[model samples]
Target chain A: MDRKGILLVVSGFSGAGKGTLMKELVSRYDNYALSISATTRSPREGEVDGREYFFRTKEEFEQMIADEALIEHACYVGNYYGTPRAYVEEQLALGRDVILEIEIQGALQIKKRFPDTLLLFVSTPDAETLKNRLIGRGTESLDVVEKRLSRASEEAEGIENYDYFIINDDLDTCVTQVHQIIQGEHSRVSRNLELINTIKKDISKFQKG
Target chain B: MDRKGILLVVSGFSGAGKGTLMKELVSRYDNYALSISATTRSPREGEVDGREYFFRTKEEFEQMIADEALIEHACYVGNYYGTPRAYVEEQLALGRDVILEIEIQGALQIKKRFPDTLLLFVSTPDAETLKNRLIGRGTESLDVVEKRLSRASEEAEGIENYDYFIINDDLDTCVTQVHQIIQGEHSRVSRNLELINTIKKDISKFQKG
Candidate 1:
């Protein structure tokens, strides 16, 4: 059966290690494409337009919104950031699961618009471990670490809305779990409607004989 | 965080090879327990209680129904068959996923009673392939094969109601896919409420400090 790829929306706390997990997952797996967001913010030095982000003007970004070209968009600190629909659709058409690393609000928005999208929320095993990750790995001050912890706390409230909640304790295990989840989701009845319909029709025809 | 195992209800067309797939899955994985059904039918020679089935009298079966001891039940050819709740509950509490191989009617009943149960419907790649396997392996006459095909056609209508639709083309692939799906389901938010709630509470407490 030829199955289309899924839209995988991943969100997590700051210290959940989702970034590393995603990097390893994409690097090891051949069937995933990382989504590139379109933004109105100016690109920093050494940042490529298509690589880091698809940079656009405020007018262009709003135009995309009007044209329904963006899957989900948000205005943060006066700049617009959104996921472009074309790239995701292209990757999915080629049978590659498109991975979108977004926040809870964007994740929910995409899921609402595209019901087939799989929303995953990642978190550390406990808060103490998360705190240590934030403090131990950073050169930032205590205030910054506390701010990140507060953001994580806010994010924790929305974990219930996600389809899957992953505990990312080990990098290799988390990667395998996430990959297998995506693989398993491909077999969902809703996702494999074409294949199922064909088999249903064939069986119905055979019954008449 | 510790979590309870899920109730996995599997159904399929007659020639889908689900029985072989499940046997290999349980043999390869140690965390699964195949569920034993209770029946009012007289035990055939060599069939022991609690092994092939939990044999019971007509009165005992009706009493179990009144007591709500059976998860799902149906009468076929004047004999009653049902799944016992106590054994399933015990296995789940022990963190072992219980596999219940049943028909579409019983599968839907269990899903209705316990919404957390995962319902999977298996089929062959196509009707012709299923017919070939049925005729190739069985000693039954063409009339019986035709009856099985007819039944399969009726069962196909209920495939859309299942959470997943598996194509049983290769035995090893089917077993691995089923195992991964069950493994991935353990990460679902609905199944891991205790773990999620603890994480939420711990993060909230951390934010306060």
Candidate 2:
């Protein structure tokens, strides 16, 4: 049986180590593909067009949204970011599991369109760890750190709806758990009923004679 | 966070290699405990009580049912068989994943009581393989083989209700998939919600200034 890949939406608070977890997962599993998102924001130095972001103009991004080409899209701080539907579908069709690292709102939107898609919420072991990690980065001001912590609290409320919660206390363990989750989903009988029935029919034929 | 063990019920048609797969799983994972069933049937030579079967008397078995001590029970041919609830619970409390290799009806009964129990149905890759395996055993007559094959068809219908379907085409692959299923179920947020919330509270307290 040709196994179809599962679409995984990962969302978490800032400094939850989602990007690092995703990198570890992709490196460990050959069947997983990290989805590349499109953005209207300017790319930083050394960032490639397809590698960092699709790098589209505001007009192009809006046009894509108007055409319903994005599986999940959102406006963040005056910049437009969205996952392209075509690329995700193509990867899934080729039997590669697609991981979409997105924010909560975008993740929810994708879930509405693809109810079967697996949604995982990543978080640090505790709020203090998350705060420390954010402050340790030295990229944000104290006010920004406080703002992100407040946002994290709000995000925690919606976590009950997620399919899985991965505690990012240890990178290797989290990645291994995520890998098992995807493998387990693929083994779901409901997803492979067609192939099972075919095997059953073949068995029945042999028994009749 | 302390992770709880999973209750796994595996059932399949005879000659589907369920026993072999279960043996392989227990040997590979140190934390998995196989539930040894209690039975009124006489034990074969060299079979020890509490190891192969609980070796209960008819009166003892009846008393167990009266006290609701059995997780699931049924009479096969002329003998009574069941899984003792206390033993399974004890193993689970010790943080070991419990594996119960029972029949389809018993599996469903267990699920009805413990809705969170993971049900796995094992089957051969094809009918020919099943037939060959049964014949290779050299213990049944042609008529018995025919009866077993007919029963296999009925059991396959129950596959739809199972959470996972493991095809015993290759022993190593089947065992690995079963391990993945158990690991995946362990990672479910529904199962780990309590621990996650406790961690969240601790983190929040630590973040308070």
Using DockQ as the measure, which candidate wins?
1
Q: Docking quality tier of candidate 1?
A: medium
lDDT of each: 0.87, 0.85
- Residue pairs with clashing backbones, model 2: none
In model 1 chain B, the worst 10-residue window by lDDT is B73-82
Model 2 spans with C-alpha error above 4 angstroms: A42-48, A202-209, B41-49, B56-60, B199-209
- Give the TM-score between model 1's chain B and the true chain B: 0.83
Worst 10 residues of 2 chain A by lDDT: A200-209
- Residue-wise C-alpha lDDT for candidate 1, range B148-185, written one tens digit per residue: 78888988999999999899988988898998888888
TM per model? 0.86, 0.91
Assess the local accuracy of residue B19 in candidate 1 as a C-alpha lDDT between 0 and 100: 73
Best by TM-score: 2
